[model samples]
Target: MIQPSNKNRIVYLDVLRVLAMLMVIMVHVGDAYLFNAETMTFETEASLFAVLLRSSVPLFIIMSSILLLPIKKDNTSFFKRRFTRVVIPFLIWSIIYVFLPIPNEIAFGGPANTFTDSGLNVFLYNLMMVPFNFTGSNVHFWFLYIILGLYLFMPIISPWIKTASKRSLIFFLSMWGITLFFPYLRLYFPQIHGECDWNDFGMFYYFGGYLGYVILGYFLHHHNRLKAGQSMAIGAILFIVGVIVTYWGFIHDQNAFFKTLALSHVENWKLIEFNISFLSPNVVIMTAGVFMLFQNIKLSAFMKRVFTELSVFSYGIFLVHYIITLWITAWLHNSMMINPGLEQFLLTVLTFSISYGIVKPISFFPRSNYIIG
Candidate 1:
């Protein structure tokens, strides 16, 4: 999910790394508003923002693909370096979140239900599941799993990536694009393209999931470097259209749900979330928009140095930032002093600062990269 500092780091990649992490923080911060809002039938800032911010994780994936695909290193070497930077730190944080007791609601005073188990017996049981799953409390870790899969696939696909013509890669992406509509297809028919409950592997399953983004990243890497103005102009249109489709789908679904469904199910909002599924076409468009828009960034000297450091510690901050997110966002909103519009922005900045502060010092200790990454 994160890349290491490189001797040949591209400026925009570093800048994009910082923006991607910040966008991730924004997503979490916005969730505080969404899950705790008074009504589910209407759009809030969080819901509006979710349409655009769904691109956050995909951006990271594309960036990882752009940076790591056509993998030069052997499998063992690549896994050694990537897993050390990602999985070990992930495991460490998983343990911390598992054992740490949050006996009260934290997400804008939403739910304290992350870790209900206590003591060694409970901790051991949860620890045993670490290799398999993370609880809803640590939902962000889901990205970690997707990324690990991509990492595993990277070396295996490197040869294909190296040899495949641009046309061939585009063909793969086109096939994957068909799979993007599978979720909707499931609504009208339980199965499609040779898929069923038993046959989860459909005709295009091989071409779907995050793998397309990996191929896209590599293909786009070889694309002609468009002028900054041209790229941003086109990217902005795609980004706006993506946002409109996502938001429209969200609002339409929410209104329909309210008309037919009872209001008691707080989690019913997930039904509405179906519209914004990250695997869908809207997100893919937004992801491409972000990839294009960021590639042309030109940072000043001082800002570049600052972002370079941020880029290095971004993964570390991501690991620890969620710990304080709900708690801080709740306080900010419950305070009633900060502008409602600004709560999310302030929460993102504050959480980023706090997480960065915590990780920066730990990064100095020996072997801490393996721990704090």
Candidate 2:
């Protein structure tokens, strides 16, 4: 079993953070081009990339679990650190997004327009709605709300995790796995109406949702006994299976929706958007495999430096990268034609680079960490 020290940073976790953030950008790039594609071939290629990158957010969740589940610190310190690091920036970014104009091409698929007319009202309304809603000005900020909810439960769950036996952890994970299938169950068996409740007892409630990823991270980090070779083999198989499931699932759904509803190509594409949810079994599997693969990697000095720099600015990049991605994608959309795959790759790179550049300067200012970190 490997236990992470609170004082010492884990190199593999840093690598995972860098990779995950890049994947997040990749998915956004793919979305920009794929949704607007005029050719089935381009859409198909982009969809494959998007599905493969769906594990990006799950990786972030799992990495958070690995770092926070051990609970070696007190609640006061934990809350204070998390608040300054996460909550404050989330609020700042939420406000920024509220006033920031949505590109009209991206917003209404027409000429661009600024939000100056009703920006104040929009900001106030978003501020009011943020507490109860995840769809603040930026759709991607839903992650902030989810992570906050997870943090709320961290203190409550950490104590149990500290002393949890392997069997107990396995039981929790098994229940979590069962809950992952609930979406499909509901889809196929609409008549199954009752909740998994036994006279007000939330039997499956405690063992489900993103909490499963949390516990899974802790289990893999603390209790996993597999060798590097074994991990590599398992990771490869799981990753391949996840790719097949996601790619084929989306394709199947898109075709079915087109045939059944006789919808346009873009409308059919939207129908399978839910296929990329983090709760999907394929995404979970891919996230686990990728996490395990990184766990077994030993970084060289050059790679370590690069990963560390990117990891340090990862939070800021995540908060700001969407804007960069959208602008670059819009520019590309208006510019000369290029291959969708290449456009996505270029957009992702540019977004990451520009966001990193912007954050790096801001990070040097006094107390800027509160806004960016």
Candidate 3:
């Protein structure tokens, strides 16, 4: 699972970050069609496509782990750097989203959850609650919470990861893998292995969630010894199997029309949550697969520079692209007579490019990483 490095840079990770960003946009684009459509036929099938992209956040987390694990800096420095790099930018944008009136009325008419323009009281409430959750606002902002938590937990686990043997990691991943199936397990038994209202600890309680991905990424980055061709082959198999399972499972459980990156449009959100949760086994498998595939990417010098720039702007692009995507989706749906699939493609392209254009310049301003990161 050890990641190979090229001269002075890890270009494959850069490529993965860019791919994840595009996948995220595609997820949002699929959401636009699913929620806006009058019925579920085309829109629902298309939205189901987002299951393939569910690994986007996991990819981001894994990339973070690969770069930050082993705790090169002290906890204080790590946290301080993370705070400036992520939390500050997140707050600025979140505040911007809360105050912006874009959600009140899409210029072309679409989703209002884009931003909060309800009133002073509602905006304040959302702002105040921002410290706690991302309720009644942009759902994508939820990534910030998960990432922040992972960052906090990083130092706690770093020592264990550094000293742990291969068997130790394997055991941890096995337990974590068991937790991945907890979503399906709960379908048959609600309180499995001591998980109940009074006591939330299950058999693999500590091994669940995105932390597994952190360790998984660490293990892969430092432990795997396979050649590029072999790794890619295995990655392809895993990714293909993952895609099949993810798509079929989500589609099988889904019949009623509903849809996102927000599943508010889906009438049966429980099914959506169960099969496509980012923490599920299938998604994790898919994440591991594509991540492995990306590890062996070949990049030209110019392209390497380009991917690096895109990676740097990726976080800001993520925060700002949603609004632009909403606008683009509404305009495309209202003005264009095109296939939903084609529209989604164009929507992802245009939104991603436009967001990059906006972020690249702002990223150069003084202390802008805090604002744009």
Candidate 4:
């Protein structure tokens, strides 16, 4: 049985995680709607839906940080374990996806720059590109690298983080500030990009996420002042507010007087756009909402059992599921051309079934369970 603690293990984190994973899957499925010739442009109804669903990615990152944070260990031990778990799978999949070119290209939309004639060899070189991320070759797997870097620094960072003092809070806020400002530096002050250090979380966006979830995780593990009911109420309110804000901004494109202030901005009112990926204020808002929902809510027996199982498979599900999405997209483009509605429905069903189904059997292999879980 899973043990509960005031500041430690929280069931709601897992619940939020499972929900976030499903949202990611749903976002990808919704993305398929875009591949349709009629819906390729920004103006189309389906395209707008795709844009709205982009929150799923940020949600996944936020949830991952929140869940992964409480797994406290020494720096060396933490690195060893996380490397064996998150990084190893990322590397293996990075290679497989590179050689096969089956799923990654489709899911992430090809290499950002040049593709070479040498297939396997070029991919190996691309794997070497992992550390720097200059070429942006390993795309999604870059997150694993970045997160691993954060984990490495956690030994030093954690002590400061745990201090629970004003100075520590300043440390975190300062980190958040640099993260927010760096991208702007790249845009307006191009020279800074060359001089600035590029560690794993140094990417700013990932750093913010790393900080947010880690802090939240620490807070959750250290404090249990709120009961489940309280968490749920807060979560519900946050979710409702988030929905209203997202819908107001994206769909209606009208900033109601109050909503305008709700938008992220510095003191001078230079608007914060596209910062969710980098841990914008909106992300913090949504994170609170998601966190509350998971903490406050209890699942029914059926859902509880299923979520338990699903959460077990989430790692593997995350790893190879995109491959399923890619193949589904391919199948639709190749064979399932008739009836877009049916094609989409069947494609989603088949993708989920195959991905989820394969996870268990594949997980049976030695040391494999860590890959997805």
Whole-model Cα lDDT of every candidate shown, in order: 0.78, 0.77, 0.79, 0.56
Pairing residues by index, what is the TM-score of model 3?
0.89
Residue pairs clashing, model 1: 105-112
- Superpose all Cα atoms of candidate 3 onto the true structure and report the RMSD in Å to 1 decimal: 4.9
Flag regions of model 1 displaced more than 4 Å: 1-7, 37-43, 103-125, 259-269
Q: Write the per-residue lDDT of candidate 1 for residues 1-373, one digit (tens) a residue.
A: 2234455777887888888888888888776666544754353777777776788888888889888878888889999998789999999888888666553443222222344454445456557667877654565687888899889888888998889987898899899899898888888998898887788887888998888888887877677378999999888888888888888888877776677566645456557667887888988888888788877888776677777789989899999988678667656664757655577777889999999889888987999979876
- Model 4 stretches with alpha carbons more than 4 Å out: 1-9, 35-40, 43-72, 101-107, 114-125, 134-138, 165-210, 220-224, 227-230, 247-278, 300-303, 333-350, 370-373
Lowest-scoring 10 consecutive residues by lDDT in candidate 3?
Answer: 103-112
Report the C-alpha displacement of residue 298, candidate 2, in angstroms.
1.2
lDDT of residue 186 for candidate 2: 64
Q: What's each prediction's TM-score? A: 0.90, 0.87, 0.89, 0.69
Candidate 3, residues 184-231, lDDT tens digits: the string is: 777688998978899989778998888999989989988878899999
What candidate 3 gets wrong by more than 4 Å, as runs, is: 1-7, 35-37, 40-45, 103-120, 256-267
What is candidate 2's lDDT per residue for 11-105, written digit by digit as tens? 89999999999999998777666654365433777778888788898888888998888777899999999999888888888778767766642
What TM-score does candidate 4 reach?
A: 0.69
Tens digits of lDDT, candidate 4, 36-129: 4463232244434444344455555555555555447766787787778777777676666655556434344323444555454665666676
Q: By descending lDDT, how would the candidates be arranged?
A: 3, 1, 2, 4
Ranking by TM-score: 1, 3, 2, 4
